[model samples]
Target chain A: MPGVENCLQEAMAIPGAIGASIVDYTTGFPVATTGAAPNEDHEAAAAGTADVVQAAQSRSLFVSAVPHDLLEDLIITTAGGYHLLRLVRTDFDSRLVLYVWLDRLRGNLAVARRRMQTLADELTTR
Target chain B: MPPAVAPSRLLKQAADDGRTGALLVGGAPGGTVYLVRGAVTYAESAAAPGVGELLTVSGRLAARTWEAALEAGAGRGAVGHLLYEQGHLTQGELELCVLGATYDAAYFALGRPDAPAEFRDDVRHWLGDVVRIDPGALTRESRRRTKLVEDIFPQPGLDTAPVIPVTRAPRERVSMTAAQWELLVHADGQRTPADLAQLLGRAGYATVLELRRMAALGLIEAPPPATPDNPDFVRLPRAHGEAVNRVRPAVPAASEAPTVPIVPSGASPPAPAPAAVAVVPAQVTVASAPEAPARPPKLARRKPGARLPKEIAAEPPEPHPGADEVLLKRIRTALRALR
Candidate 1:
């Protein structure tokens, strides 16, 4: 099973993946990191990401009669790269998220998504 | 080099060099305490009610009292002493208030020379006797208390504003510790965690810190940051709006299928699980479906004598269950299991 460090290594190994970090979304603080740190403050980024994920879930379009579960993943595509945030629900007090920066040209969106899900599961179990 | 007479000495010498007046002191026990200057300006304490807050929230004095006190000729004495003498506070209460205020004021005062001191000599002249605080001592004390509070509950933002719950909580729920529960109960919408500590007769910094810790753990909402430009506006609604949007979309199609179906195997019904899953599909389906059918009944019913109970009448005709209510239910259920 992958630990937090190995999880980051695995994410970095993804083609076009530049850096990765595990963040505690609830407090907006970084839990672990790899690659050159993102230009944004880690805490602010985590908090802002959580806020974005939350906002997307509650839009009038999404809030129908059904009760939804927690957020699973959020992806933001920019001109340069893709930012992928995956929420990992664990028994720990703070919720964790895997933040990965992927180069737009080198990344395979489909494979990255699958690998992230698997890595999140492994990290949480370990 | 005389072994660099420590940071404390340097701070004290700096204060003296600047000629900042007065002193305020505080601490937990025997060690060196914290101190602040005499003007008693810009004080905050996790141990006692802040002076202005104490005056405002205690119901003994009004804003006008502070204004009047501020304007009152030298007869009124210091605001801190007047509070004590007028049966508004006890000696103990006064001490705590002074301690908190002085420390807060001193915190801002230290290492800054150009900034105008909050309290002037005119104000002090009216205050009668100097509060007689040892500025250096109180500074040390405040620092120690702050550290203790942070150690217990690491998040900040507890001391600056009124305590307000971000979500409507259940009437009964369990907290991880008794102190956490006390912090919650004391969290009135108007008081910061530090103020709440004073009002509830608990340690100020400790309460603020613990409250923030609870907030981080999703037990409570952090008090919104203080913004002078729009003091009355609440930030929680915005935060709630954001939180509401972040959840995954619970599509109706997903809920239509039985959450945990017991399919028969080999021509025999599979043994029922020990406990049936509490299916929330009905709720999900209702929430996700279009509102076309729900709005008309209310529009039609309003035409005639509509004499439903007030509570039911108050509800929106369509009665869309709020996400917060659903989340609260889930939290309560989860907490119950922990108990």
Candidate 2:
């Protein structure tokens, strides 16, 4: 598994990737980050998007679901770009989520999602 | 700039000068704020949870593992550094953990401008400096957190007051966040937010935020004010706002009940079944508080050999109930340490 920095490097290597961060949405903390801001407050975005992640994973939302699988990834499409959030499954703390901002014009969302899933699987915490 | 010389400005000044060591801020629960060349590395308040606590709370590291890590990092600057080096936590995780812990501490530790500021040069926290927080930003964040709390509860005094759950609900079927549930469960009407944080080994801010949310919803009420001559009022000095009533119990009348001299103060936690006395952890400790009227002692019924139910028996002999509770809590901490 690629290390944390290596994973960020890999994500940035993807075409049109501009920013990446590992945030513990539960605590509203951005554990790690790479890149420039997109004219918005990174803290606000980091804190606000947490609710989206929480709302999606809430048990109430899953009450009538056919699939028992927890959320794998979340994608937000803006007018200029896409904000892809890939939730990392961990034994240590379940709060960590990987967030990447991609340029919609140049980045391929499907490819970024697949790569993030692989990274999440390989990621391990002692 | 605010007229009073704030700790944040002092921190900013220190950062500009590129100084290193720990700044011991003054307050009731004053604390140390660690800086590495002006950037805030870590901070701790007597009232807030530290990173070490956060690590131990979730059972993240086993005892042996923690001991091994502790041993390996012996004489090193910070155990958090060892944690990162050993791959126990990624640098990202480590920084984030420290940031969360430090901010929580700074919120309480730095707010008092009047509190004396003592800078200890060259002192380093056991966790070392994983993240370097901009002093200006840190101040902004701390202020923001304070504002957030005010927005929710608009009262700072409750942070130290015991939580008393509302006897009657304002509305039916109240929904709450998970953190709120934990805070309410541990509220025990005697322990304040800081006490609950220490007991639960959770962040003080987490407890504060959850408690304030409850206050906004009217799920809980402010603790009854301490009596003017209350000894604990003088003993437990609050640095923030009003003096805290450390001796305030969920059932104030129960403590005032006739003392049964036969029971030992060190008695184990009373059996949970006693409906007569509510020792149910902090929040709901006194369902009978309103119903139980204070009665003058009828000395005729009590003999030296009378057997009392474990409920009232657990705390009857101790004249200083607060001190006894502290002792019992210490014992519980010791037992947990052994485990």
lDDT of each: 0.48, 0.66
Q: State residue B14's C-alpha deviation in candidate 1, in Å.
A: 25
Stretches of candidate 1 off by over 4 Å are A40-44, A57-65, B1-339
Error of 2 at B42 (Å): 1.3
Candidate 2 off by > 4 Å: A1-7, A24-32, A54-72, A88-96, A118-126, B1-4, B71-74, B224-335
lDDT score of residue A5 within candidate 1: 62
Error (Å) of candidate 2 at residue B132 is 2.1
Encode model 1's per-residue lDDT on B255-278: one tens digit a residue.
433533645333343333322222
Listed in order, each prediction's TM-score against the native is 0.33, 0.68
Q: Tens digits of per-residue lDDT for model 1 on A10-125?
A: 98888788878776443344546688545755545655665665565434234333565456788999898888888775431234578888888999888888888877776544
Choose the strongest candidate by TM-score: 2
**Per-residue CA lDDT of candidate 2, range B231-314, in tens?**
233333332112112223434535534333323443443332243344433444344334323422233233345444233444
DockQ of each: 0.01, 0.16
User: Which ten-residue region of model 1 chain A has the weakest summed lDDT?
Assistant: A56-65
Interface RMSD of 1: 20.7
